[model samples]
Target chain A: MPLGLNFTQIFLHLFNFLLLFAILYFLLYKPVKNFMVHRQEVYRKEAEETSQNLEKSEKARAEYEEKLAQADREIAGLKAKSGEEAQAHYDRQVKAAKDEAEKILRDAREEAERQKAAIVQEAQKDISDLVTDAAEKLALHQSSQENFEKFLDTVEAGRAEAKN
Target chain B: MSKKQQRKMTVIFVVIGVLLLAGIFLTAGASAQEEDIVTVIRDAVIHDTNKIALFGLEVNPGLISGLAVTGILTVFALIVRIFVIPKFTLVPGRFQMILETMVGYFSGLAEDSSPHKNRLLSAYIFAAGLYIFTGTMLELFGIQVVTTAGHSVALPAPLSDINGAIMMGCTSYLFIVVGGILNNGLGGVKGALKEFSLPISMSFRLFGALVSGAIVTELVYYYTALSYVVPVLVGVLFTCLHALIQAYVLTMLVALFYGEVSEPSEKKLRKLAAKAQKTEVRTAEAA
Candidate 1:
């Protein structure tokens, strides 16, 4: 027959186990549990914060992208507007210079015509006066012989003066 | 549908088929031996240094194998490591910000536990605990697969074997070492030891409770001539309670120990940080 474990021995053994557990529970178990719970709570709080941060970052990213797009559009629009303004100013300046040149040419031509007309009139008047003076000297020489002689002397003298 | 989806579906099917085949093999093997797993656990407990009793009764081998203490710890560790830890970690797609937050929080924990704001010790403890628990549980479950798959492979005994004792001992030692290292980094070796004692008890207390619970369950079943259901139910209840209580207690003790260890060094560390901050401010002002 096997030496079976008696009921009393078994009972005592079990009781001893429980007593050990009770002691450990208080000394080790309770404290450890509390620590774990505290850690877990801390973890949960952290997790919540992390989730919020992630959401915030995502939102910030979206906003940034939107702002970037808006900035790009604004920059492009300004560039186009500035380019058009600059081209317009250049074109206006070129057109004004061309008109000024035409006006100056017209004024210069008119002034040259006026100076040429005055010179021609003066030359015609001088030519008529010289012709009349020459005719009068010839007529005086033909009037009388003695007077003609004197006139001839006068003509010769006039000739000598002209030569000198 | 698409090629990719088809490929995924095929992979899924292959995995399912493999799992089914493995399950069948395991069941066939188990049916052949039909030896109760609980018997092995009971014998193993008897061999351990911890002689725990429960409820004024000694439990049987059947209960021991069915409700093993180390096995429970392994399973819990696995679930937390594989499921909970990863969920908390949240890499790649979901909650990357959350992961960073967790990292920052643990970094703070490291600062609190150490004298010089070093996170090495705290991070190491967390990772080691996570890994140890995960590895042990996976090993246990992997052993179960063999048992069920018509394989003759036996489960590793937790007691009487040098390996088992070493593994369990190392686990406890790791907790102690981590605690000590954190304090040592902060307040020197002597202070580390003071802090290490808290975690040592944390690890040992669980083992004690588990052993006690198992022994008691066996005693009740055999001595009192109680109904089969009653013993099993009581054993399960006590075992769960013991595990829960141990986990909770260990956590609190470690946290409190952290607080205590960090207290003395506070003044010196604060002064150093303040001086550093002041220097930085002055430099900035000058610049």
Candidate 2:
């Protein structure tokens, strides 16, 4: 068996490597590790803050959205109620106007009918009085004419008696 | 003619003088105080590195520029008005009037924030806001907050990281305090605190908006390998858009906070009137 490395040489190389490792640990590895740890701490804190901020934003957004929706609902309900009320008001006004118009028309028709009946009754009474008067005048005239003719006959009889 | 009498009067006056001096000295000595007082000013400034990093805290150039300009202008204007204009006030100059008007305007703005109609609050707010804005802009020139491995990190440029934190903290604190005072005065102290919520949101909101816009714009520019002008234009446009959005949001929050306490009475009056009208209508119908 052929040994490529002597024991003393091997041990010396090992010691040299160990020294290098120690120096690297202090100069590069330790500092690097510390820096990385600090950076990580900062990162972790930042992540937590960001997450908290996101949560707050989400909560605020949800609250705002809820308020907006509630306002919309209130507005819609108000409009519907106002519309219903307006419609009711219009209907009531129309009904009152129609009733007033009907009442006025009925009153006018009644007055006209009464006036027409009074006029017809007055005409009939006037016509009947005129016919009665005419009949009385005719009767008087006939009686008077008969009496005059009788008087003329008497005068003729008296003259004949005196001559005898 | 009266030298002996004069001498006697002088002696009496001198005696009174000495007596008065002695009384003054006695009072002064009696009032003298010597006490060893150790006042501890606990300026406990609590800060979180993570919170600062998450917001990508940086210097603001616009704020810094605005402050420098405003300061220079104030000093120049003050010097000119106080010295130069006073020398020529006999002519009733336009410059004097202009100066007066400017002062009056600032005074009025100050009065709005003052506790008892004073200009101190206004002046303080203006100065602080200007300083904060300027410092923020200066910090923005180099400091950047970046996300790596799903965690945010504050990568400082030339300035130290602590300085960056302090700059951002100062800016946020200034805005919060001033806005709180104004809001509180307009509403109440509690309301002011409630109003402070707006600034708290703004602290992060402005940063978030700017960072997101920058990232997107940078990504687009990178992928497109756009020209210098293109990148600059995109960056400016992004910044402007972000600014407009931030302003709108801030305005909305202020208005909302103010409105919460102001609008209810008017609403109540309107409701009462409506109810009265309904009752009147009902009475008329019954009649």
Please tell me which predicted candidate would have the highest TM-score against the true structure. Answer: 1
Span of ten consecutive residues with least summed lDDT in model 1 chain B: B156-165
TM-score of chain B of 1: 0.45
Off by over 4 Å in 2: A1-4, A114-164, B1-287
Q: Candidate 1, which segments miss by more than 4 Å at Cα?
A: A1-164, B1-186, B195-204, B220-227, B262-267
lDDT, each prediction:
0.47, 0.44
The C-alpha local distance difference test score for the whole of candidate 1 amounts to 0.47
Proportion of the native interface contacts kept in model 1: 0.00
TM-score of each: 0.34, 0.26
Q: What TM-score does candidate 1 reach?
A: 0.34
